[model samples]
Target: MRLGAHISTAGGAYRAFARAREATCDSFLIFTKSNRQWAAKPFTDDDIAFYKDAVAEHADLHPVSVHAAYLINVASPDAALWEKSYLALREEVERAGALGVDFITFHPGSYMTSSEQEGLDAVTRAMRRLLDETADTAPNTVVCLETMAGQGTNLGGRFEHLAYVLANAGPSNRLGVCFDTCHVFAAGYDIRTPEAYAATMMEFDRVVGLDRIRCFHFNDSKHGLGEGKDRHDHIGRGQIGLSGFANFVNDPRWADFAAHLETPPTEDGEDGTTIDMNQVNLAALRGLLASSSA
Candidate 1:
């Protein structure tokens, strides 16, 4: 697997590549805009050029992904909110295309008191609309729907839910999946042991099909199995712990997938509290894999 993290694009889109490099990442994830807000600053030609140049210089870094804003919820029952979500996502797709990113990962929305079938249908329709609108642009940039935490009325927490969305998407190659470790653990897919991990992944292959998995958000869970909570802890520090990540990083099936750390930045002077945690996680994971091979 190409190891990396979600790096900040504070200066410009291209600057994120430098940040990823500093973190010793072979791949990275970035947001095109402030994730909390509905509005985003328009991209300039310079932004596009800079991003293209940076990516070209980093040819060894494969599978760079763009994470969609948190505010979007395609399954929203509120029509206005759903429209806003669609437009925002559309803009993100265009921006990602300009930057030449391979995939854009987004969360499938919550139902908000709507029936499960209704919510799934709404998400499917919205996704189809997105594909139609952007048909002429960014054909290579696949939109990856992330699995949710199953909190409240959220959809896509189940592997079958993601499979449903993919199957409903028809023949479009623009759709894919981004699996989050914390979310899946919270949604009750056990990864704490090698046997359990194999079982869980086999079930995913049987349901969602591994071919659809494009990216992974590598976070440890602070909550236990079946907790339905979405708290993320640093690698090896949380409930899922080091063994869980060991299983994840050692898996050959994910060799081509972009594995990114979304853990919070560590504070100054605190032990293990730095962005270098990405490097630390990578080293630890490598050590584990080496021992297992022995």
Candidate 2:
């Protein structure tokens, strides 16, 4: 698997490539715009050129995925919010296309007060609309819907829910999945053991058809199984522990996907958060994989 982390894109889109390289990442994730804010400064032509040049320079980095903003809610019951969400997502997709990224990952969004079926329909419609809008520009870029934590009315926590969206989507292949280990564990998939991990993947294969899994958010949860909590703890320091990561890292099926660390930084230093504990966690995971195979 290509190991990486979600690096900051504060300076410019291209700068994230350098940041990821500094983190010793073979792949990386970035947000095209500020995740928390609805409006963002428009990207200049220079930004696009620089981003393309950076990607060309880092040709060895197989896949660079862009994470969508947190404010989007395609499944929102509120019509105004839903429209804004769709527009924002369309803009992000366009931006990713300009940067030459192949995948954009986003949470499937919450249902709010709407029924689950209605929410699913709304999400599907929004996605179809976005695809239609960007059909001419970003034909190669796939939008990856992420599995949620099942907190309150949030959707896509279940394998069937994701499968449903994929099946109903107009261009099925245009849609994919970014599976979060913490959310799955919180949603009650036992992946801490080899046997359980296998079982969980088997279930995913049966329901969502593992082929749809394009990216992974490699976060260990702070909560226990079936807790439905979305708290993310640093690797091994959380409830999932090292064994769980070992099981995942050793899995041959995820070899081609980008497994990214969304965990917090380790320590502070003069050079902007000098120490990153995620590197240690990734090294430990690699060591575990090597030892297990040996």
Candidate 3:
């Protein structure tokens, strides 16, 4: 797989490229705007030009993606919240398209007060509308439904949930999946051993098809298996050790895929100073790759 991390776009979206390069990323994920906000300042003509130029200069950082704002929850039964989420997601798609990103991944949404079937149906309708409305604008960007940890009433804890949306959202080239390691492990899919990994993947293929996976969030789970939590820890330092990661890094089927690290940074110096842990975590992952080859 092409290893990378979620690079922060703090100063400007264009600056993310430099930060990614600093961490030696082969690809990367970014938030086009503030992930916690509903509104953002419009991108100016100069901003667009500089972003495109930075992408050109860093030609090696291929297959970049944008994670949609966390506030979107299209599965809500409430009419107002549903409409807001649909619009927010639609805007996110347009923004990702404008940036020429390959994919836009998002949490599938929570059922909250509704039934699982109701939530599934709502998400399907929203996805259908999103694809139809953005066909022209987001022609090259695929909407990836992320696997969740099943915290509270969230959907997508099972592969079947994702399959429901993909199967019912009508046939479109703009739909896919982003498999999150921490979420899946916390959701009960084991990958700590070779046999367990093979079984879990077999189940995924049966339910969602391996071809639908376009991106990955390579995080380690802080909680144990089936804990249904979303805590992220450093690679190989949490519940999922290096052995679990080895199965993923060595999988030939995903050799060309973009696997991004979303792990937290660590403190490396005295006086509680923090360090960029992307380099550290990515190095550990690379070590797994090297050992497998050896």
Q: Count the backbone clashes (under 3 Å) in each candidate.
A: 0, 0, 0
CA-RMSD of model 2: 2.2
- Off by more than 4 A, model 1: 270-275, 291-294
Better of 2 and 3 by lDDT: 3
In model 1, residue pairs whose N, Cα or C atoms come closer than 3 Å (at least 3 residues apart or on different chains), thus clashing, are: none
Please report how far candidate 3 places residue 65 from its true position, in Å: 0.8
Model 2: runs farther than 4 Å from truth? 268-274, 291-294
Q: Could you give candidate 2's per-residue lDDT for residues 1-294 as a string of tens digits? A: 888888888889889888888777889888989999888678899999998898889888759999999999999999999999999999889888877788899888999899999899889888878888988777888899998788888998888888888888775577899999999999999899889999999999999899999989888899999889999887887888888888877778888789888887466768776677767767766777755565
Of the candidates shown, which would achieve the greatest TM-score relative to the real structure? 3
- Cα error of candidate 2 at position 232, Å: 1.0
Best by lDDT: 3
Cα displacement (angstroms), candidate 3, residue 38, comes to 0.8
Q: After superposition, how far is residue 243 of candidate 1 from its true place, in Å?
A: 1.5
Give the TM-score of each candidate: 0.95, 0.95, 0.97
Give a tens-digit lDDT track for model 1, residues 96-203: 887778989988888897888888888898889888888777878999999888999999889988999899977677899999999999999999999999999999
Model 2 alpha-carbon miss at residue 224, Å: 0.8
Residue 139's C-alpha lDDT in candidate 3? Answer: 98
